[model samples]
Target: MLPLSPAPAWAVAGAARVRPGDAAWPSAARWQQLGEQVGGRLIRVQSPLVACRSEPASAACAQLFKAVKNPYFIGDDVALTQTLGWVDAWTSMPSAYAVAARHTSDVVAAVNFAREHRLRLVVKGGGHSYQGTSSAPDSLLVWTRAMNAITLHEAFVAEGCAGQAAPQRAVTVEAGAMWSQVYDAVTTQAGGYVQGGGCMTVGVAGLVQSGGFGSFSKRYGLASGSLLQAEVVTADGQVRIANACTNPELFWGLKGGGGGSLGVVIRLTLRVHELPEDFGAVNFNIKATSPAAFRRLIGRVLDFCSQALIDPHWGEQIRFRRDNTVQVSMVFQGLTRSEAVAVWQPLRDALAREPGDFVVDSSPLSIVSTSARDFWAPTLVKRVLGFIRRDERPGAPRTNVFWPGDQGQAGQVLHGFESAWLPAALLQPNRRDALGDALFAATRHWPVALHFNKGLAGAPAEAIAAARDTAMNPAVLDAFALAILGTQGQPGYPGVAGREPDVALARQQAQALGRAMAELRRLVPDAGAYVSESNYFQPDWQRAFWGANYPRLQAAKRRYDPDGLFFVHHGVGSEDWSADGFSPRT
Candidate 1:
């Protein structure tokens, strides 16, 4: 175990390191002092060392473990729960210290301390990062959970939009604010809404930075597209704003480039849409008695997606589980129930034409007509529908409502599960048959969940092409063409837990995921992946996530974060650093 080292001359007032096996290791006062130095609170959350202790449990160990056990269940302690995948064996490495940041100064102070100490630094927002990029072993964690603040403006003008158009309604959210918080403030306080992630507990900064998708994505655009300005603390400890008229290149990279790679985002301003008067949703549950029937149902849904549902006003999610159960959930804006049904008549007609002996349970397929305020009520979303896991019940129904509250025990349920994404094109008739056959054969030995949607399909070509100006993959905009013969994978949902206590078994499972991803890559070499929901072990992460944009993103990293102060697994310039903050390239 490493011993505590002396502080550097430039260390902050109370900055100190708590190393393993040190005499000061068990002192809560020492941890508290370090937190005070940065003008924030310190928390000793679960770490691998605590989990893998060889000695019999001591009183101190028990207290620490208990304190960290359910850190994410409380909505107010934003710093504690930002690492959703922190429990994974591969991602279980914990920082030596965590600083619950309360302001921009605290972040700047933390960054300086880390640079002086040569310690790895990780920034965390909502901690919903699928790849566990927000955490690492023996690093300094700057948790932004305490910095949540929301400011609403009726007619906000972005720096770039000042001269061209009238001011628009917008909201500026601090880094720690979650999707549910943004949803609540926008719908109620501002009388509007923004297209954001499906999970309310997800951090607004992380989601927008990684190219967010949501129920209103078809109508509005990705959450990233709504970003108007961002206040960031750079690696060099300088606070700056990135927007269309400010540090525009950095602004471009920050949008969809990936979070925790370029800088620590303290605040983000985004455009908001007025609450729609007419909104509708339809739920369908189709059960297949035989394999052929399941195949037919899937094919018809895919056909409906590719043909009849090209409009951005339509949004749907199709979930297929291992038990031959199928569910299709749809939501739309600016349409009444009858109008929505008229638009969806083709899908209903297609289902009528099916010759298979499957039951179409439209009993749950009622249309919802309500205002955005009623549609996105936090009380309704959080208490009733939030925190439901994909593995809870096979073929269970899902809604467009997002709960902006604590996930409680649900956060712990989905730790070690392996997930993958495939493009929407592969769901076509001929290609989908082969893929479904393959998945069915594979699932005979293990359970798998498949989610199908047009998350990035409706954006105009110009919008898709515009992603090239930033770090987001342009391939996302080309879903129609990309889906022709290959498949693109979707991001993982929150709380996909893993139960591999044995390290060896965990490694084996990770290897299997790698092989599976490799096979998927082989099928669709030209298609780019969604960075937010991918596995960290991508063989060629640059090409897999960024495609041709890797070089530009790398340049941005070199220009802004020259010393590599911020490094996330599989993020831009991360190839230069090893898991332990040592250079593998050297």
Candidate 2:
């Protein structure tokens, strides 16, 4: 774990930003002029779910409720976000108006308008933010849903780096492009790989800026580390090119400094890699009969990870459940099916020796591998593999598909979410038993998932080196895995009658999730969390999210957006304003 510096007292309080009822708010003529500047793309935003509240028994209301279940549908809507809300935390709320940005010029116009008018500004692409950072009521929104475009280059170099940097195969992704679209274009069609978020509908710009991790991140490192250049519109409405050679400090801050902070990224260029030979997944479950057996099971699993699975070939998660079961949903790269099975043989044998204490729950261990290129091929996934769920709405693109495992997150209300990086030292022979005990105790409260790919330890030296340069907490470079505990309710938003979230149950589960993470904190008290996945109410957010890198990121934030024209909850320089981002401190 990295040591944290004291929180800075730099931000000063000031007056609130302008809102709907303010006398200085934009008039109808001003809005019309701005709309004309953007080619009439302005939108007066309102949630389509409002119909459900008005006509409870209408057929259209029923269809609308079912459509919210589709992530792509939610992403396409201008007013809705992928997550509905969090109990006593935040709910999805639409901005008063939005500029449906179709190009960089549109984004620039929106930024200028918001800054000049002192309007609360929000940016939304895929709208997958679990913390409700993308949606703000009574604000002006820069909606990038129409800006999605993907282009591949056989050899590309950042501007002003022709002599210093070598050309590499790369892909330029627009702010609104989803991982599903990028995967289809780069890997399925071009036969090359680009690291990105595992979820299909997550936006490229948001994920890259938030230190993205995918199933193959152990081999390729973070998606942000692969960023070569970005076209961004800053607070002053200047479209600047940021890369290793130009605006280098801003480039570093953009990589894992957390999205919607430094500037509005219009597009990004990321290096691509040669496709691996194979991609595969291994899944199974084990149930222990008693507490002692569960502890022993955890120990065996840790030993297996330390011995073999920690390497670059493996990734994904292992879940320790309160039901005395451990669920394995691990993925692998560059390995054939037989090779993957052989790798797990030792654990299988170890479990066989403990028949009296453990049982193979229902399904036996299943290992399957496929040609790497077929992993994201739309046709193959839809017809042959059947591992992904497609957006079945009429006229939806074939590439719009998501993993079945991610279905629970689409439009769901979060209860609580917390993450902590577990350093490799805990996996040592001397401390492994204590780690096992902590895992058991944590499961007594709520399920704990260890996401191996989210951390860089045990990865290739080059992968670790690349990740170290990013603004993500340096602790990730040494942590073997990221332990996460999260709870959520069904697919529903607040204020929707008959479809409202169960607040009582959500609060109850949230407390249990908090207790579960507290158990892990006892082992690594000062562990830094991944910025995009940490607690929404983190007290020392700057230290917890960026660690020693916070000061550097703050410097860049000051240089580019000194007046703080943009605001997201707990984002950089957010301390200068009220929680809603409408009022500055006095």
Candidate 3:
């Protein structure tokens, strides 16, 4: 690894600067001291390569291989997973140190220490950020996973809302709590539910900070919209409470501003909704013998979304693969099996009307009803099915039932991908067909999947307008304007993988997505893109991520973090710093 130059005198004394191979680099004794300072929770991470080198034929190596084989298993542990492995490698180019923050005070101490020592600091919540903002080269990482805690309030009020006439139901979640943990807590422990991400292992703080979207988004609004208050440790090491009536500007920024930009969010208080007794869902799969049939199927599904799925109560996801197959899973909050079919009659009729060759075979359309609590339980069946159906690994022989769980080398190198917003206008039958054709042609040579998440659509006009009240781009609201209201582009989900091991091929795919996104942006130049899911190297990033809100967010960054102490790739005010957390070369 190339060594970074010394810090400027104004930032820190010469003796205080720490960098890999420098005299100031923390030794084991220094690490112990730092741990003591943070209540003895600091941990020195071993390189995965080193961890897997325990006598290649030993049980230890076998167990390590097993643990790393499953992405989900690695992701569940806060220490193992970094959303994009390539970014992690880059971030660790310069030696990295971590502080497992267990309390607000620990974060405050970490911030103060890093600031005093002129060290780049990165806050990690779940470490699932698609852009890998949670990690940085030569930085002190404040890991919040140890601080997981949840508190439910029957009659909750915002920090400064005591005078309000109504007290809302709320849950206060620490930064480290995963979505699944929060889901179980609210549903079983508190008899309530808060609109959250679909992924079980996503961290609440990172999701909410980046303007969360999920199955209930159309009904309850984005997760950020439900935020009532937050406790944050700013760059100056001060812990402050932000709410509608206190530090309101900060509160507004925190709601939708991308994570790791403004401050380290220690805790969040979000409003909750009562859980319905029962909910309905439909799972459908259609296989087409040819690409023409696949296109026809896609057209039909888009037509259905444009017509029958506009109700906020309806939620669904549609996915299409290169093999000319489509799978659609839909859920309705209050509808029963028959009621759902009645509502879906138009789509059913459309499918029936399609030419006989359009579908080679299809599963019978059916609705499965279950109690809300039971319906939300995490199940391994879907994952197992996905594993069974996954395309053969490159260069591997195709097989109906092959498990390569323990066949790979100890350390694996992963790649990153880019996701772009799709304009809502393209949901129209003709436009949808055009968009589908464009995507199919653009990714024909790559193994990328095209997914249309319908559940995140149809957000109420008022809700869209409300997004403007926070730092979140109003374009996100417009993206939800599907079908009759004219289409708008929607932000892409960050978790989707669109990468290739070949750097050149990855760049080619990224460029394709970027070109597509650029065209979509031209349709609404004033709109913004989703920061979390966008290309890290996006041009005109401020406008693409925050739109008209960029100016205000920049001003807030300057005010709250004057020294530019809080920095991340693609974050607000980050342009002033280089990707390696250093001043850019002129």
Best lDDT goes to which candidate?
2
User: Per-residue lDDT for 1-586 in model 1, tens only?
Assistant: 1122232222323233434564544356645666778755666655433342543255654443344333333333333333333224244445767778897888887887776655678888777765767667667788887788999988887666678657888889999887766776787556788778766767889998887767666666668887888999998889988888888889988888899899999999988776787666777776778876776666666667667565566764555644676666667887877888787677776666663657776653455566667555534443454322221233522321233322332233222333334555665666866665554443333333332333456555544444445576666654532211111111111222222234344455455544443444456555566777655444566776676777777778878987677878878776565554434343
After the best TM-score superposition of candidate 1, give how far the Cα of residue 492 lies from its true spot, in angstroms.
19
Candidate lDDT values, in order: 0.62, 0.88, 0.62
If candidate 2 were superposed on the true structure by all CA atoms, what would the RMSD be?
2.1
* lDDT of candidate 3 at residue 372, scale 0 to 100: 75
Instruction: Tell me the deviation in Å of residue 223 in model 1.
Output: 1.4
Tens digit of lDDT per residue, candidate 2, span 1-586? 2343332343343545898888999999999999999999999998876656777667887787788789999999999998888888888888999999998999999999998898999999999998899999999999998888999998899999999998999999999999999999999888999999888889999999999999989999999999999999999999999999999999999999999998899999999998998999998898898988998899999999899978899999999999999999999998888999899888887787879998874344378777888887655544454677788889999889888888788878899999999999999999998899899999999999999999888889988988899999899999999999999887776667788889899889999998988899899888888878878887778878889998788778888988888889988788777899887764
State the local distance difference test value for candidate 1: 0.62
Give the clashing residue pairs of candidate 3, or none: 423-489, 424-487, 424-488, 425-487
**CA lDDT, candidate 2, residue 482:** 92
Error of 3 at 399 (Å): 34
Deviating ranges (above 4 Å) for candidate 1: 1-37, 40-89, 159-166, 343-356, 379-454, 460-468, 480-523
- Which parts of model 2 have CA positions greater than 4 angstroms off? 1-15, 361-365, 380-385
For model 2, state the Cα shift of residue 544 in Å. Answer: 1.1
